[model samples]
Structures are given as structure tokens and as C-alpha cells.
Target: MLSRTLLCVAFASASTPLLADTVWLKNGDKLTGTIKVFDGGKLLLNTKYAGDIPLDWKEIKTLESDQHLLVKQDATTGEISKSLQPAEDGKVTLANGDAPKTVELASIQQIMKPKPVVTDLVWKGNIDAALDFQRAENDTDDYNIAFKTSATHGQWRHNAKGEYNRESQDSLTTTNNWDAEYSVDRFFTDKWFWDGRITYKRDTIEDLARQRTVGTGPGYQFWDDELGAFKVGALLNRTDFEYSNGEKDNFYSVSGTWDYNRYLIGKKVEFFTNGEVGKPISGVADYSLETEVGLRYKVTEWASLNLKAEKDIISGSDNGDLDKTRYTAGFGVAW
Candidate 1:
């Protein structure tokens, strides 16, 4: 019923001419013109003197204009509808009033179509070292030596981290857990951004755990320039944690992120700080306000190294004894 309603509004409506609208039918043919399709697969495409060609297809290709050097065709039958909902990532969601499929504009050829820049594209990378000391420095306190590296492009970011943490004053030592992760984000305008994450985390404390999270809420770009920009955004990451202890906990975070960096000398100075004051929204969970700061140097225009230090201030009614500080130092090269 929803699909039919949208199809009526999309295809049943009277449309002016669309400039260079193109459609390629499933039978191995491409049509350049304006097209409107109903829920039952009925399609109307209009092109110059050739008139409107009614079509029915099992599937549909893209609707594009201006590419094939077909600009002379002119938009006489329908006005390119700005009606197509534009996404922040600058792409059309291709909602023919039917099941929606996301399409990235960067990969698509620009048409007379409207592609709104829904989300800003961001690219970043860093390597840093941290020095950490446990509060008790006793037999059970986690002591550490660490290393970390990360690089990110567009909506995706990846990180690899490792460390050596000792339990107690025992000569017995344990290797820091090895960790790797991938994360992505989508911006839905109106100061709203959605984050999706996938992780494989291994470390001394938790052994091995794969976590997933979706963070979304109000966000803004405070500053953007060669020096740095302040981004003040609020978000909530609903997370699922599967620990090596054969235990499961679900946590949600109401957090804020602040990131800024600039060049210093021939190197670069990068700083990122994120804090989340949150408690487990479900099940039995650990809560903490986590933060990390770092400075990185660019060896060349393509390489960088950094030192990072982090502190977790645990203060909920359930986590008074679980306090710890951690650090890591590392570097990376990128193209």
C-alpha cells in the first residue's frame, strides 16, 4: 500500500519534460529521456520528436541525462523533478516510490538530475604512542606498553592496535591484545549523522570480543580549515559486546566528539578528543567516560607518526573499582 501510494505520487502525476533522461531496458537497450514508472512496472519515457515510449521491465537501470552528448535533446516533455529526495552524501536514494536502494553520487554520472550534498566527505589517518600506568600498580593492576595505527577515507575508518599489559608485580607478563576495526557513518542532514561500526577486539583485559555499534544524533562542524576545525556533535552508539569471558553486555553511549589538528613545522600536529558519559542501557554493563588525545607528525606529505594517551574515568554506581589509564605510540604511511 505504501509503495503504491508513492508510485501514484511519483509516476501518476503529470510531469513536465526532463532534460536528457535516459533509461536502459533489461532487453539490452539504453533509452535517453524522461521516465515515470508505476508500481506495476508501467514506465513512460519521453525524448524529443520520438515522443514518449511506454516500457515495462523486470528491473530498471539508472535515469541519466546530459552524458552521451545528448544535451541537444532538450527537456520539452517533463521538468527534471527536484522532487527526487537528495541525501547528504550527494546521491539519489533511487526511491521509485518502491523499495529503496541507496546509490552513491560520486560513483554515478551527473545527470540533469538533482543530487544534494547530504553529508560532507571526510578523510583522516594517524599513528600514535601512549604511556600508561595503572592506579594500584599492584598485583592485579593492568600495566601497559602499546602501539596503534589508523587510516580512514570517506565514510570508512580502520584501526589496528596492540599492547603488552602486565598483571600484578609478577615477572609473568601478558601480551597486549591485538585489535582491528572498521567503522562507517552516514549523514542525514538536519544536523543528524548515523554511524555504523564493526569490530574485532582482542586484548589482555577482555581476551577477544567483536563489537558492533550504531551512533546517531545531532552534530555540527565547528571549524574547517588548514589549521583545524572544532566539531561539536552529540551521539549515541548502541553497542553489542561479546567477551572472551563467555559473557554478553549491551551498552549505549550518549557522547560528544571534538576533533582538530594542524601542521607544525615540517610535521603535522593532530588532536582528537571524544568523551561519552554513558551506562549500559541493557543487561549488566560497565560504564566509563572515555577520552584520548594525540599529536602526530607528518614525515612527508604522505606519512605520519603520533603519540596518544587515554584515560577512562569510571564513576557509575556499578564501576567504582574499575579505573584505568592507557597509552600508545605509533606511525603510518599513506597514499
Candidate 2:
């Protein structure tokens, strides 16, 4: 009976998945967890007891992992190793089947799990919605929703975004508008790309009822990583405007666009902003600008609370000048 009980306990332990990664700190404390990624001078570790933890790379003495990983040294391309073996303090060994390479910890630039295939696609995006209702002297209703998504495969990336808003007071509509845009980028190098985009907007209660634009430009990606990304571009656009009184105008424009985001406090909070500013060559409008800045706080792994402000301005439309500003607080999901 005693032998049978011991065998049963051993079997259960063998069946459980092992947290095979280990990191040793300079202060003589040892940690066991799965290594997630290392970037921006931080190494992320996943542990069952404490969740994901970010450790400063400088504080690490040595680390080892049995899982296959890609280790990037300095700025060179990464090499995959079957496992990491502990070496002397401040050094590690990358063990393959026949070749074992030892390198200093300070020389390692990044570490991450290797993708299953070289051309694997990655997709990420988020959606947010807000609603307000008042039932007093002046009944008011307002609704707003926005979404943005992107997919990247190899050297190509595709992006799409849209927004809808409506507001009513005393059973009368005061604002209604919707807009959508799609863009594609083709990379010629790691940090440089060309982009083509098309956009359309419609306003049901405004004099400038419709706007359409097509543009192409060159962009520079400053950086993209687990923490955040920022990119800027300049475009030459052909735009058409239609007014409610059967008036139409078309013109060429020069524009600049930017998108930026950052994560803070161990990825609990995010700051984001994206916008476009343009000057029309034909004087259809003195200038046009559309922008939104927002912050999101993660409430859970996938859900978040968001606050945002948006501005839309057309300085000299044919029918009249248009300027609007809106503030929103809402909940969202991000992946």
C-alpha cells in the first residue's frame, strides 16, 4: 500500500507542466518562471503565483530556459537555440544540438519565442464605445463607437479604422456623422515604407455633407515593440467635397499624418494619439485637421476603460467654416 501511494504521487508530479525557466539575481535570490520576452532593457517573466513580472536586465546575474528561444545579440539577426544553459555570472550558454555558444548577458539585445514560421501573420486592434442619455427637461441621447485594427504579414501591413457618432436633443437630431478609412503599407526596408490610403466621411446634419480623399506617401517607422510604436508620414492627396446646397469642389492637398502609442506602469495604462493635418492647394479650405488623443487603463487582460478627446476642423469650407470638439469616456477591449 505504501509503495502504491508513492507511485501515484510521483506520477501526478510528472504529468504536471514544468516551469522550466530560471533567473538568478545578483542579490542571491532565484526565480522560476517562463520567460516571455526581453526588450527595452526589461525582461518579462510569467509565473503562476505572481502573474507577469518585469525584471530589470541589469539586476539579473544569470538565467536558463529549456524552451526554444530566439536570442538577438547586439543588432545582428537573431539565432534560435534549443535551450539556455547557465554559465558564469553575467553570461549564458545557448545550447543547440551540436553547437553551444556562450555570450555575455550585457551583449544580448533581445530575446523572444521564435515564430513557428517566418511569414506568420500578426493581428492586433481595439474597439471602444460610449453612450449617454438624459431624461430631464431636455431629453438627450448620444452614442459614439470607434474601432481600429491592423494585420501584418512579411513586408506588408494592412490597416482599417472607422467611427460613428450621433446626438439628439428633444427629439431633434443635432449631430450625425460617420467615417471610414483603409490603408496599406509596403516596406522597402526595416524602417521605411510607402503607404496608400482612401477615406470617406459623411455628415447628415452639416452643410459640408460629404468628403472623399485618396493619398499616397512615404513613412518612417521610428520604433515598434511590445511597449509601444510611433510612425509619421507625408502625403499628397486628391480630395473632393460636396455641400448640402448642390455645390462641389475638388482640390489637391499636402498632408502629414502621425500615429503614436506607449504603455506605462507595467502595461496597465496606455497613451495613444493619431491625426492628420492638411493644406489644400486650390483654397477649397484654408486647412483641415482631424485628431484624437486618448488613454486606456487595463481593467483586465482584454478589457479596458478609456478617455478620449477628438477635434475636427475645416477652416474655410465653401458653405461655411466647420469646427467641432468632443470628449468621451468609455470601455473597450484590446488585443
Top model by TM-score, which number?
A: 2
Clashes of each: 29, 0
Tens-digit lDDT track for model 2 on 1-335? Answer: 99999999999999998757999999999999999888667788888787778788999999999988988874436788899999999999999988899999999877888777752345679999998999999999999999999876657889999999999999999999999999999988668999999999999999989999999999998866667778999999999989888899999999999999998877899999999999998868899999999999999989999999999999986678889999999999999
* Least well predicted 10-residue stretch by lDDT in candidate 1: 69-78
lDDT of 1 by residue, 45-84 (tens): 6566565455553344434433221110111221223334
TM-score for each model = 0.44, 0.80
Q: Residue 218 lDDT in model 1? A: 61
Error of 1 at 82 (Å): 29
Model 2 bad stretches (over 4 Å): 2-18, 22-32, 38-63, 68-119
